[model samples]
Target: MIRIRLGARGLGGVRFAVSPMGSAKDLLRLVGFNPGTLTPSWRSRATDALTRHRLGLLAVVGGGGPLGYAPDFLRPEPPAFLTDIDTALHQIATTPQERIRYELAEAVNGHSWDPGSGHPAPRQLLQALGRGEDHFARRLADEMARFWHAALKPSWPAIRTRLEADVTARASDITQYGLAEALNRLAPNLEWRDGELLVHLRTDSIHRLTLDAEAVILTPSVFVDRALFCAGEPPGTPAPRTPLIVYPAAKVDCLPPAQDPLIGATRRKLLAELSQPRSTTEIAKRLYLSPATVSYHLQILHRAGLVTRARRSRHVLYQRLGGMV
Candidate 1:
């Protein structure tokens, strides 16, 4: 449990931010298959994506545990709303060597109060960084780049749209429901009580913090189903003015492809089947649609620019177009 005592100014100090680095880190966690803290539905969806990509560094970066901690350098303060991947990567590359070592130590060393198991992969990687092995650091950075392009960039437009919608919803909540209500609705385990905000963390340990003047930055995330609380400063120290709280967005579905209600059921089924390349007979067999009906729907899908066809040894396979979703 985490308790944050808020001063008089806390109510008006709340702010909303969209964090690109945070989202990337969250997706890295999903790639590592560490969805123990996520909702069942999200876990299933994330697991499917991870299996499809099979990123090698995901398991390594996950640190061989459910609590895989990506080095903090990867998550800088949220940059501009449209911060590019290269800019974020450059910031990470130039992180002060000392800061990298310090954050890595904190992540690897078990918290003084809680003796929960720690992650080894990060520990080893930290050692490499400690030795000033810039090569290893560069390698990890490359993996981050690859992971973002393959796993995230493809669905980023949809994710960004959902994030914007969430921000709009939060703004409405603050106006209509008031600040306290908005804070409470941030997560199931959060509550805004008299002069304080309470966060019931999944862990058994309880921690207390205070936010004197800095407003809390509330970042809505598509991947973080559970609330993630980060103290601006180390634990047990004087509380910083601004702390960050990242929680799952209200809409659980990250990327529901643009669907046309006017399109017939068979076309919808064909579009769904064509998410991956499939032959007409294969789609028909799986969807229980006749081959002729499948063919008609495929032709319609092709005409609408929703799908494309390519010849594959004695068969013409169809797949959803790149930009349609």
Candidate 2:
């Protein structure tokens, strides 16, 4: 069933009230960057969105630079020396496994809806709940973390008390695994020692680093820089909104070859349009439907492992999942 649950959500500045599910790579192109090159800035933004919301995109494309300066929520509590920000970004960039663990913990703690493909089905929730602890694999943490965040409220106040408790429990779990302490301790130091002006990171550790630059990010979310909290405090600290996407299952083709009309028609259109790589509105106009309807179709196609979806400014773009056919 389609749903809208929020606490942390994102779509660049749009605050994505709705996100249609699809393969992560497809999501990359739709968001605005060419997947072929996989730009660091775009990856940073998409990862930030995913980190906060965990909509199931395999990866995200660049929409633009992060909004304003890094917000306070992303900064460490009470702040520290400017070197700390550099340190955090450096470590994150250097260690992908830590980031993956962090993301995985988030997926387990926050949103872990089972579209019911493989392990950890919704039925397993009860069993998982009864279990004492959540295990996180550093290798898988990056993508898993994005998925986990899906469970959180888009903002703090809107969050359920129990979820808040879950956040604490998860935090404990993270401490057990070392993500929290690592970020607080090791990460910031990395940037400081590296002597880089900006540190860029991705899932599975950092993909890039730049010294003699400006601004750095530990997670892809550009909104929060470790440096900000050290510089000063922020007001209100608006949390990033949560993002969600729903799609019918019959459409995706992850395991083996499969076909369904609802899935096939939509998939065909996505492939045809990829050459030009049109935006959501353009696809809707071409498909002759409302933007919302077009989005829903894309969502289903996405979940079924067919097409990809992305947000560019106010638009939600779509691309063929892959194989060019």
Candidate 3:
């Protein structure tokens, strides 16, 4: 468990933003290498992309340590708004040498490497980085750019749309329902109580941190199936940086092709049924279709920008977008 005490400054600074590089990194970490929690289609796509791409260094870095810890320099803190991939990559490429060496050391030395664990390349790379090889950073950035182009860029438009929608809805929640409620609703693993936000991490260790004046950035990712918190600054850093909470965007697993044809009568009926927010089960019961069928059509409609989804308690409520009443 990670406990964060959000003081007034931290509370006021809590804001939402979309990070392209963050999502790409998470996709590489969770989908490309780890491969669980994603839908079948998404998993297949990621596997195919990884098989086709030559992302050697990226694979090693994103493969993570025994503790599932990726080097933090790969995902720099994003701005308080949507940023393009180019900008994020540049930040990684130009990271201060000391921070790079420190983080790489942490990632490498913290784990016990074996021959079958494919530690040779990483060990060599870590040695190179330790010797102040500036090219390593640029090489990492280049590989990440290649991976993004191969795996994420093709579907980025739809992914970005979903992330933006999540940010908009979360911002509205913060405005209307208060930040505590919004925090509680982010995921099943998070809770905000008595001026402190509690995050349940996969690790059993407990970490307590005070927000002080540092901001809490809420970033939404379509690739991350679970909530992740990137907190604390690298050791020996000059100043503390903002902490980030990367949560799974609602219904991200249901993303389909953005240009699916909506000619089916069932799709039309489903759209009409969404005159009010309804769940898949509700729509299936109303239209006499299986819940699976309703979910499939809804995924298509959502990708086509014709519908929006929100998790209301345990049910995901779908509604028609625009003035499509």
- Per-candidate TM-scores read 0.64, 0.24, 0.73
> Which regions of candidate 3 fall more than 4 Å away from where they truly are?
111-121, 127-133, 203-213, 234-239, 252-325
Error of 3 at 214 (Å): 2.4
For candidate 2, the lDDT comes to 0.32
By lDDT: ranked, best first = 3, 1, 2
Q: RMSD, model 3, all Cα superposed?
A: 8.5
Residue pairs in collision within model 1: 214-241
* Residue lDDT tens for model 1, 160-219: 655765777777777888888988888998888987777777665444544443457778
After superposing all C-alphas onto the true structure, candidate 2 shows an RMSD in angstroms of 21.9
In candidate 1, stretches whose alpha carbon ends up further than 4 angstroms from where it belongs are 8-12, 33-59, 62-68, 111-127, 133-139, 203-213, 234-241, 252-325
Task: Give the alpha carbon lDDT tens digit for every residue of 21-84 in model 2.
Answer: 1122223333433333433433455556665664332321112111111111122221221223
Clashes of 2: 42
lDDT (10s digit) by residue, model 3, range 1-325: 6667778978888878888888777876775346766555456666666677766667777756444667777888887497778899998888777767666665666532333465533565565465563787888898888878877786677677767767766767777898789899888788898887777876653444444434688888766656787745533453345778888776522323331344266786786787678999999999999999899889988876667687989999987642211
Where does candidate 2 have its weakest 10-residue lDDT segment?
13-22
CA lDDT, candidate 1, residue 204:
56
List per-prediction Cα lDDT, in the order shown. 0.62, 0.32, 0.70
